[model samples]
Target: MRSGLLVSGRRGGSGRVVGMLHLRVVCPVDATDEVLAVLKAHPGVTHVALFPGAAIEPAGDVVAADLAREATDEVLSALCGLGIDHTGGVTLEQIDTALSDAADRAEEAAPGEAADAVVWEELLSRTGEESRLNATFLAFLTIACLLAAVGVVTNSPVTIVGAMVVGPEFGPLAAIAVGIVLRRWDLVRRAGLALAVGFPLAMLVTFGGAVLGSYSGLFDRTMVLSAHQVDFVFQVGPFSLIVALLAGAAGMLSMTSAKSAALVGVFISVTTVPAAGYAAIAAVLGEWAICGMSVLQLVVNLVGIVVAAAVVLALRNRRSRTRDLGRPLSNG
Candidate 1:
């Protein structure tokens, strides 16, 4: 498989494959007709091609096509029901840029605008992996809190924003919402474990460093009391909940549409990491009231995001007739 860098050169100017998927299939020779029929039946799929006897391992025919992002789950469902996954293989890749009129028409032919389409399968897979309680997740969350700690002490908005971007908490938070929408209780439990264990652990680690720094004359109570921006991090109010709700909605939209920039904005918009950091820092300084407030802030943001994201996903689910999508597999 080519790395993402290698695919960058294929970005033609005429059309953007922003909301499309590239599907490659290896199947037994006899199944080529069935695969073609499935691809052709979808109004949102295009650029279908078949190469006979192209597989070296499975030693069968190869079928390739481009599909609208919205149609991905439906097509995959149809294909999977054919038992292609067991006898053959399938691969789906993001098409960053496709400079073809056929691609444009393909998007236009779909149920909704490419940008508004929700590829639930892709979203679930991506978020599910991220929601793992792994060392990498812990590392990013710790680093973010550590950065937030420094930002709180020094009163640096830039550092705070950097911490927000570095934080990986959004993954599990998003996974929780997605899981709820899909009624995937296992996903919810796993993601809940990640958040349940990841945050306090990161905060505990940050708290130790904060205490060590304080004893070494690196921090003081004055720093906590005088900082302006950290004030926002530690304060809980109606607007805090409001901003979180807005960010959560925007974040879900970005996830569904695969919008990178908007996702970044969601990262910066929430104060989860910063609140965790501030709470730890305040605790180290013996400001129990401030620490409690920061913890409350953290809770508000987390709950608001989860509730808001679940709503967005639930609505999208109601709008989609996922089970009835695509044509039934041919018996021939």
Candidate 2:
């Protein structure tokens, strides 16, 4: 049996976190099917898929191999346990060697530390294109934002948090982070357009709903200028920014690590959409100062997510490279 190292990573989708891994191994083509079967038995892996390449094929001098995350641990164990002469298996030492080497190479290839990558045009485009899921998300975000606005006016925390959970905006935001990392310009565009359009749509719907509520006697005049009375008021302060940063970091980490996405509920608690919802209400009610605060809150949260995602991806890339080459520096 052959053995080598595997490094785990992430690939972002519209609302779900995607996992990726790179493996370095020496094994025969005839046994390739057996090798893959063994790897697929691991618990920590999901979305087990393969990308074939000539560079790493083991047989016919092809020098290529790939195993999915589901197969990770078992595959490593099999590699270690196998009697055949080959290279690559899962090990802490192997992983460390790969990551250290990648960091050094990246430092050299980059003119400077890799500045945060933002595929602006692509981001805008992908968000604009309509998809069934994205359209549904848009509708949900509108309803949630509207509900949040009402909750803020009524000074109801429960309603506000309910709106936050119901808001589907985070999915697209996560997609944008993923698209950036994968260099998937199409997805980037889709996510960007969704954000650009979704926010206004949500604001408009909520504003109209607020007006209707006021006319219907369900909403009172006192509610118009309401700010702190609302449970949804933006938490303004350094801590607010800090929370955004931490949430962003966690969100990105969830995307890159194993089973970490289960913590997405924690990220939703950061209150990004709720803040936006509140700000929109302020605008409808002509509360300029409150609106300003809400806007600031949203901006901070957005920046936090993007910045954190980029940092995590950059680190993962470096780590992947180091593992693949078995060195602290790329041959380049």
Give all candidates' CA lDDT scores: 0.86, 0.56
lDDT of 2 by residue, 223-285 (tens): 555545564456577777677667666765554443345445644567777877888777766
Question: How much does candidate 1 score in TM-score?
Answer: 0.90
Cα miss at 255, model 1 (Å)?
A: 0.4
- Model 1 residue runs over 4 Å out of place are 1-18, 57-59, 322-332
Tens digit per residue, CA lDDT, model 1, 71-146: 7777888888778899999888887776676777777877666776777777888889989999999999999999
Instruction: Give candidate 2 misplaced runs (Cα > 4 Å).
Output: 1-133, 224-232, 258-261, 327-332
lDDT (C-alpha) at residue 278 in model 1: 91
- Model 1, C-alpha of 123: deviation from truth (Å): 1.1
Error of 2 at 5 (Å): 26
